[model samples]
Target: MNVAEVMTTRVVCVDMDDRLTIVKDILDKAPFRHLLVTEDKQLQGIISDRDLLRCLSPFIGTRC
Candidate 1:
């Protein structure tokens, strides 16, 4: 199969300075489970649902 055949054209991206709350909110509503973290239009890293869960687990009740 070709890369284009299975690749997604649209993606959910968030800035490096974006808060975890924002990440959680986006992931909650998004169809996929991963988020692309960028800075200055450059790809920095990727965060998944599980990863976000782990990070947010520490501060459950209060605002992130």
Candidate 2:
């Protein structure tokens, strides 16, 4: 088996400046684990669920 055969063709991407809330939402709603960060249609970096969880505040979505 090859990478292309196992990899997803329908990619979900986010902007470089997108907030953690947006990233969290996307990841939460999607079945996939990775999100591509793009700038002006160019790939900037990749973010995973683990990355979002680490960067997001623990108090997020909580009422204090």
Candidate 3:
């Protein structure tokens, strides 16, 4: 299936300047495993659940 077929259109996204707390809340409450970071309604990059977890590592703490 194409991404548009399975991907969530009502995506929970975060702006570039949004705080981590907001992103964390969306990650915790949303069903999706990845979030699309956007600016001016344009896609920037994707932040996956694993990426957030990796940020917890001491070696890469806050890397995300």
Candidate 4:
């Protein structure tokens, strides 16, 4: 199947300077787990659910 056929039409993104809470909220409600990071209307990077979890996870817990 073509990417257009299966991909979601609704896209969610966050600004480079946006807080982690914003990213977390978007990720929590978004159908997709990934959020595009943008600056000056340019795509800078991407963030995923796991990435957030990793960042939020306690340092006292699993391997670093």
Candidate 5:
């Protein structure tokens, strides 16, 4: 089956200048594991749950 068939259309995205607090809220509310990062209405990159967790490592736990 094509991924588009099941992929979410209402994606949560954030601007490069967006605060981490807002991004965290979206991540907590969004059901999907990925967020499309955009700038000036253009796609920049994809941020997944893994990326968010990695960012939290500095404050939460260190990776070995």
Candidate 6:
């Protein structure tokens, strides 16, 4: 099967300067696992849920 056959059309993207909180929020609410990082309307890179999770603080979302 081709990638287009199963690919999702509704993509989720984040700006380069966007915060982790925003990324986390998007991932938490969306069903997808990856996000396209862009700058000035140009694609810069991709960030997966795993990548965000790895860089997140253990105390994230916790009252410290």
Best by lDDT: 6
Q: Compose the digit string of candidate 5's lDDT tens values, residues 23-42.
A: 78888887777888899999
Please state the error at residue 8 of candidate 4 in Å: 1.3
By TM-score, who's the top model here?
Answer: 6
Error of 2 at 61 (Å): 22
Report the CA-based lDDT of candidate 2 relative to the real structure.
0.88
User: Please, what are the lDDT tens digits per residue for candidate 4 over residues 1-64?
Assistant: 7998988788788999999999999888777889889999999999988888878985634777
Between the candidate structures 2 and 5, which one is better when assessed by TM-score? 2
TM-scores for the candidates:
0.81, 0.81, 0.68, 0.82, 0.77, 0.83
Model 3 spans > 4 angstroms off: 1-5, 58-64
RMSD of each: 5.6, 5.1, 4.3, 2.5, 2.5, 5.0
User: Cα lDDT of model 3 overall?
Assistant: 0.79
Task: State the lDDT of candidate 1 residue by residue for 1-64, as single tens digits.
Answer: 9999998778989999998999989888878889999999999999988888777586755598
Candidate 5: RMSD to truth: 2.5
Q: Worst 10-residue stretch by lDDT in candidate 4?
A: 55-64
lDDT of 4 at 37: 93
Error of 5 at 9 (Å): 1.6
Off by over 4 Å in 2: 57-64
In candidate 2, what are the lDDT values of residues 1-64, reduced to their tens digit?
A: 8998998988999999989889889888998999999999999999988787666666555686
Q: Rank candidates, TM-score, best first.
A: 6, 4, 2, 1, 5, 3
lDDT of each: 0.88, 0.88, 0.79, 0.87, 0.81, 0.91
Clashes of 5: 0
Q: Which ranges in model 5 have alpha carbons more than 4 Å from their true place?
A: 58-63
